[model samples]
Target: MNDAHLHMLVNHFPIVGTILGLIILIGGVYFRSISIKNTAYFLFIIAAVFTVFSMSTGEGAEEIVEDMPTIGHEIIHNHEELAEKFAIVLYLLGVVSVIGLITNIRNHPKATFFSYAIVAIAAVAVFLSTKVGTSGGEIRHTEIRSEAVNQNSNAASPKSENNEY
Candidate 1:
């Protein structure tokens, strides 16, 4: 598959996985369960890893789509900028998770509290990261197309799509 296709698939892993991890993490905190918290931590770590994959492939993806009728330099720049931020947050999450895992294995009582703190920040990070991904999608897949890509492929067509294709 092309970089765009692969990037799209990898991008969602971070969004969904991060969201799920947030839920599980919050639930674990509420229930005072170590196993559940650790599980969520692992998920967050995995999400971060995929975020890297997405970010690394992003430049190539942009190269493929930059000249498309619906795409523009601004959109690519915006996506690149946002991806940098997302990468930072995801990397932080991964590092935090590593600490979390270590803490859990060593039975550090305070680790749970630390996890809560990290996840709280991670929740915000995840939100921003998703926004970046959506914006990037919008670069080539405008709202009109996005609205119908799944239901009516015709609507997703670029208004000036003929020029590029």
Candidate 2:
């Protein structure tokens, strides 16, 4: 498949992974379970790896769709900007997660501190994931756009018999 197809395939994992990781991390912190926390850290690292594939394929995908009728350069550019921010956050989360994992495995005194740090970073990553996901969705899903939704709702409203054309 083409880069665009590959992009579509891999793009959702980072967002989904961050969300899942965040939830599990929260639970881990609550229960003080290193294993659960490690699971979340693993997810973060995998998500970060997937970001590389997503960003790499994005350029090819942009070239393929940037000229389409409903897709504009501005929208694509916005998505690109958000994606970059999200990727950076994911990478940071991944690094922090690795350190946390190492510390936990070693029974380091600072393991709890690292867990808290990972949680904070994952929180930021989750926020960025939302922005990135929305911007990316806006690229192809015109129906979800605020203006388009308003217009569609207006058009779908029933006309009064007296005003019928």
- Winner by lDDT: 2
Q: What is the TM-score of each predicted model, taking all chains together?
A: 0.82, 0.92
Q: Which candidate should be chosen as best, given TM-score against the real structure? A: 2
User: Over all chains combined, what TM-score does candidate 1 have?
Assistant: 0.82
Candidate 2, residues 68-164, lDDT tens digits: the string is 9999999999999999999999999999999999998999999999999999999999998998998899889998776798998989997686984
Local error of candidate 1 at residue 46 (angstroms): 0.5
lDDT digits (tens) for residues 1-165 of candidate 1: 999888988988887888888899888888988899889889988988998899878888988988988677887897789878877887898888889878988899879767887777688877876778687767866863355566566655546745763
- Residue 125 miss distance in model 2 (angstroms): 0.9
Candidate 2 is scored at a TM of 0.92
Q: Please list the residue runs of candidate 1 whose C-alpha ends up more than 4 Å from where it truly belongs after superposition.
A: 144-165
